[model samples]
Target: MPTLDPTQLETLVVIAEEGTFDAAARRLHITPSAVSQRIRALERAAGQVLVRRTTPCTPTEAGEPLIRQGRQLRLLLAEAAATLKTGDTDDTVVDLSVVVNADTLATWFRPVLDEVATWDRTALRITVEDQGYSADALRRGEVLAAVTSEPKPVQGCTVEPLGRLRYTPGATPALVERYRKGRGIDWSAMPMIVYNEKDHLQDEVLAAHRATRPPVVHRVPSSHDFHEAIRRGLGWGMLLDAQAEADLASRTTIPLPGAKPIDIQLFWQRWRLDSIALDDLSEAVRRAARSGLRPTRPL
Candidate 1:
């Protein structure tokens, strides 16, 4: 069995976090040559190239497991040190990295910020990713936890259903009238707005209507902007149920006729670590989800 050096593993973790050999060296207070030596020695032990030589260095497929291991080890060490410290003012701050979808951030995930704000000794790092793709961040060990649409947990992680985020196809009243085809709006002729290429809600609506995408498909990546685009008549797009209902009551936007609501089931996935920070975060997330999201029914 080949022995992996703790120092080398930590060096690789720093490199992965810093995104460059020089940056990692600066963080570690070591020379770039020294950083290179540690990585080279690690790769030799593993018999596989670990870090990809890119502008923002990334871990190769073979390196992902090691990166995760290194992070876990570092987390444990930090916790242990904090526990062992005898001082009344132990200043060990645990870095907690989490990924959340933009829509959730704009909606139900706000309370999480409030909860985290009270934790003086925890450093929070948040990555905005689409719920459907957030699991990729977890798989790569880029985040400790994620609010993801994927029901299955990543290896070494635990998953629990958070609930479903409901979306309704909506458009400005003027836009809908302009594209009205007799009794129903012309799905093929109307311009559409999508969150991004990864967004499929608009496509799902179109598929339901048996229509192809219109020539003018505007991509508004931001959740708030996407909702505003629909409101300002840029193009029709799906809006969160809360957003749509408010607009509907205000007579700013109307739900698309014959379009059914889209419900995306969300799950909370976190590394299976025996850490109080992670557990507290998970509880907070669950509470927020319960308050803001619709309960998911058994399939």
Candidate 2:
């Protein structure tokens, strides 16, 4: 069996996190030459070029296993420290990294953070991205867990159904009057707002409306801003149920009649580790999802 030096593994993890040799050295409080030497020694042990010399350094295929192992080891060490230092004043914080979607982050994910506050010995680092893409971060070992649309577990991870987020097609009354004046839509003249280039909710809505292409589009990447853009009559977009509450009640944004909401099924994927902190975080998230999102059939 090939043995790894813990110091060298730590060096690799730092380099991958920092994204540059000099940055890794500064983070580790070591000389850049020392960082380079350790990485080279690791490569010699692995018998492959682990990291690519790209701008903002990326891990090669061979490096991924080492990176994942290093992160898991760190999680175990933190859990062990918390176990040994069991005292009221024990300031040992378990650092957790997780990936979540922007929409959920804007909605139910907030409540999960509130739940975490009750567990004073844990600290979180969250990455917000699209639901369809968050699992990629987990697969790359950038995060230990993720809330994603993907049901398939990332190789070493376990996955379970959370719930579903429903999006309704919404528009300001003025825009609705402008484009949907009569029996049919003036599709070519109506501009639409989207979360980003990756957002397909608008397209799905348009297709259901029997239009092939969007007339015009305004991209608002932030969830709150995206809702605001629609409310301000910049363009109509799909709004989450919670986000559209005030507007729907006030009739400021009218729902597109007969349009079915796009239901996005969400799943929780996490490394199958025995750490209590990770298990607690998952339970909190699951509870929030159950209360907030529409129930879906179990996978």
Candidate 3:
């Protein structure tokens, strides 16, 4: 590595996160040509192509290292500046944004917040997303951390296996008797409620039967609403063990036949910054995930 220009390094980080050279240049109040020149200069210095310019840009393997380093440098500089002022910590709420699933929030994930409150920090800004999709937010720098279904690490982040969250195929008793007796879906004929247009809960179950696709679909976006829709017999859907246990015990739920089940393996993806505050937060989240999500077992 040759001598790095902090300005160019910042530009590269911005471009990678913002997804385009024009966007990054706009952010820095510099001309797009200037941004391009700086990037070209940086690439000459590094002797490798850093970014692959596509519709939405993607970092090369080489670019990821610089992007991650840039983020760490920025975070360390901010922490140092904050410490120098001491009182600046309380200036405004330092929002710590994170992407998490709705059920995990309703489950033991809250314990992480208890730990967060124990530390001296600012307000939390939580963004609920489907576990599978949270990594996009991390790459866009929209969130500092995420509880993701993906095991792969996002650029500028560290990935830790948080464990699996087991989901049981469940439905209300009345719904069960009405749908499970002999009607048991075959999945194609079953009327199923889904989380949204993009949800695949029913498809996952139906795929086991070698069915083509779900015939009936109802979209409810909220996890609580999704559970309630199943409980009300609107349609059957998969319920997370942590969220459905009480209902299942009270006989409100009737489990679907066949032992095959879906377990979503979650991971903690976070910026690998050396902030004491972030370290404490990562530990808290890890502890909560260990207790909240179930261990992965052979299906």
Candidate 4:
């Protein structure tokens, strides 16, 4: 078994985060040559290339476990130092990286922000990803936690149901009427909107109706922008129940007649670590989900 040096592992993690050897050197307060030497020594010890020398350096597949290990080590050390120096005015800031779906960010997840805002010496780094794919960020060690649709836990992580986010297929009243064919809306001819290529809610609705996506598909990636696009009559799209209800009440949007609501069961997946910061965040997340999302049930 190869023995990994703590300093070299930390340097490799820093390089991956900083995206360049020079940047890592600056961050570590060492010379770029020193950074290169450490990386070389580490790679030699491991007998594999740990990082890809790209525009922004990325850990190779073989390096992911080490990267995760480095981050976990750093977090534990920070926590231990903070514990040992209790009330000594040594404010140790811990970075909490989490990946969340855009819809959750715009909706129920707002409360988590309020909770995190009150914490001392904590920095929140949120990566917006689609729910279906957010777990991939966890697998790549890009985030410490994720709001995902995957029920299975990623390796080294634990999964808990966060409840379901219900979506209604809706469109502007005018857009709905424009595509109406006799007593029914033309599912095949109506224009559609999607948050991104990863978003499948609209497609799922179409499939349920035995219809294919129309040619005039509009991509509005931002959650707020996607909602606004629907409000502006750009196209029909699946919207969160809260968003749909408000729009429907205001006569701005209407649910497609006979369209069944889609409920996506969400889960909270986090690294299995004994970090206080992570525990605080998980509690906040669970609380917010309970308040905003429907109760978890078989999907």
TM-score of each candidate structure, all chains considered together? 0.96, 0.94, 0.73, 0.95
Residue 187 of model 4 has an lDDT of 94
**Model 3 per-residue lDDT tens digits across residues 48-148:** 99989896887787877777566566666666666666665545334466889887887869998786676543556789888878888787565678999
Cα shift from native, residue 241, model 3 (Å):
0.9
Which 10-residue window of candidate 3 scores lowest in summed lDDT? Answer: 87-96
Q: Candidate 4 lDDT, tens digit per residue, 46-73?
A: 9999999998999999999888888888
lDDT of 2 by residue, 1-299 (tens): 47988889888988899999999999999999999999999999999999998989989999988898888888888788888886753877787899998889989888898988887678899998889999998877888899999989999999999999988888888888887747656655689887877888788877776776565788899999999998999987898998898889999998875567789999999998888889999999999998899999665
Candidate 2 residue spans exceeding 4 A from truth? 86-92
Q: Is candidate 1 or candidate 4 better by TM-score?
A: 1
Distance from true position, residue 108, model 2, in Å? 0.9
Clashes of each: 0, 0, 0, 0
Off by over 4 Å in 1: 86-89
State the displacement of the C-alpha of residue 292, model 4, in Å, after optimal TM-score superposition: 1.0
Q: Candidate 3 or 4, higher lDDT?
A: 4
lDDT of 1 by residue, 137-162 (tens): 99998888999999988999999999
Candidate 3: deviation at residue 137, Å? 2.1
**Over 4 Å off in model 3, which ranges?**
1-74, 85-94, 180-186, 296-299
